[model samples]
Target: MQNEKRDQLVVSKKTYKKSNELINAMGKGTALSQKLFAIGMQNIKVDETNNVVATIYGTELRKMFKSSSGSLYEHIEALCDRQIKGATIFDWNLLMKDKENGKIEAHQVVTDASFKNGTLTLRYNNSLTDKIVNLQKDYTVLSLADTLSLKSVYSLRLYEMLKSAYDYQRAVTKMQGEMVFEYKLTELKLELGIINSGGSKEIKTELEKEFPDYDRIDELAEKTGQTKYKEYKIFNRNVLSKAKEELNKKTSLQVDYEPIKNGRKTEGIRFFVTKKDAEAVEKTAEVAVNKDEILDDLIDLMHDDFKLREIRELAELAEYDYDKIKKSYDYMNSYSSPVDVPIAFMKDCIKNEYYNNKTTKFRPKSSNSFNNFEQRNDYDFEELEKKLLDN
Candidate 1:
């Protein structure tokens, strides 16, 4: 369907088109027992092999997670377990259509998934690749790059729901007029991978061990009086709002939402999404949203959390070139002696134009002593060079 002209496409009243990014990104941490699973599933090409292997290296994932050394591998393993563990999923959305009657049918998404040797393989009960499957309707294969760059599993999920709902809504409106997508709270929770808790306590315990800093889930569980996200308010706090923040910062779309009510009892979400590039988004650049995205990528590669002020300072100091910042960061990471402060070191590197370009050395007037390598009677320059060579 994605290959077809937009004007030639058909829209079912029940089915919709969703970018692969939104689908892959839809996993959020607020999900039950690792329901917020983002495994780079855009590469899933269903075929006769009846198997799909999704692999993400630890080094690439380090951009999303603040991890230390070998601990990341352990966490990745645990994440896989949480995503496809005992009594979880059981099956997937395997819907097919009856071509003769023009009716849609349903089938399992995947029979089961297993993780071993740092790779996850999802198996199918039958040969139901995207190319051959007849769900009640045909599937639309959209572009996948947008979702792959997303860091927050929550943001990814929201993007999926919003994009899905938007495309559906757009089709409903004949691709004209202001578009808004609506979803029930219960349905939204399901999309975010927050299933009702209490399915398998034993398995949940084993999965919780993977995420060490997730005690807030338990604290909220106590207050909300149920598991798998105590309630809607808590769900929004831990999942919805966080997703909103991440999507705004990292993606091309700008997301906003309002509450729906069933006689004053809140029931769902009515979300508004506009392409940042089209809307003349604040601080418009060649691509208005690209600015933040570039900054985000630069920030993600850093060794420590940097304040927004500091990040902006670094950006200015680096002449806002993404490549220069990355190369300097990679160089710094290769050091045998780790710098005491990473962001500071980065800022200093950029300010000095250390990567092939030299600049005047700036120092505080408050300093009492200053030395120039060439001008000063530096101690044993010949000896220092000899020692460096000796090593």
Candidate 2:
């Protein structure tokens, strides 16, 4: 029983169309129809006596219904029976059942009725209030295409289709090429032609027969075409040839591959030298080191922590003048403590030693008489001798 009532309330497309037709027909100004429609629009309220009343300004009501004779109730009854035409009123009920223990816990009725003072009213018992309130908010007036002129409806639909076709053509052009989009251009042309030539049913039928595969071609072309119809074939062929050339060039490139082995293997000769050979090489290198080379190496070794001492020792061993040694030491001290002796200094020392060894007449300046040495040297004799002999 409940299911039947529910089904009746569920309006179908056909019923919705009928309702819209009624609204449009009433809009054309049928007297009774207009009055019934106006009543439906009015706000209905329940008074203290539980009687529903439809309230509006007296002048407004008269203006809408075009009547001032008889009571408002009489006017409403006449309007409902005549103006409403083939409309029917139904009484709906809400029944609640508890499945947990299987019980008919609540039952209530909701009825659609007309009030005495012309208010269209629906009443639901307290138990069914929630359901009734939910329905009221969700209710909507139905709309139908036929309610509008045929030309207006067709124009709207055709506009949408044309828009869709234009978008499809644009997308296809971006992806593939103009040739791929030829079908879309064809479809758009046909649609535009139809629209321009007056969208007559006879013309449409003739065009459909002439372009039997219109829909299929339009859909496929939308998927395949690049941008525009004129360039579709040309663009596709060019892109294909370019791609093939690129693939061929890539495949033709030469590449050398090296094989991988599980473990490392030596394919070339490996030689080993004995400790005796290494010792011999070291002794020969030591013999190659002359006195000047040994002095330079010792100077380098001590230069970092004792620059002044190393320079004094180097000067004494090389038999350089005190002034010259002092100047060289000062110049070397101007650099950072960890000094690298210039290769020029090493070469000069080597040359000086070679010349000294070759020239046996070379004499130490300090070896002259104390008075003569004193006249030439600024430092005291004892101090000069100590520095020279200490190293």
**Which whole-number lDDT from 0 to 100 does residue 83 have in model 1?**
55
* Candidate 1 to truth, TM: 0.46
Question: For candidate 2, which ten residues in a row score worst on lDDT?
Answer: 20-29
State how far residue 65 of model 2 sits from its true place (Å): 3.6
The regions of model 1 sitting more than 4 angstroms off are 1-49, 52-141, 197-233, 262-264, 274-391
TM-score of each: 0.46, 0.17
| lDDT for 234 (candidate 1) | 80
Worst 10 residues of 1 by lDDT: 5-14
lDDT of each: 0.47, 0.31
For model 2, residues 133-208, the per-residue Cα lDDT tens digits are 2233322232111111011212222222322333344455653221111223333333322111122334334333
lDDT of 1: 0.47
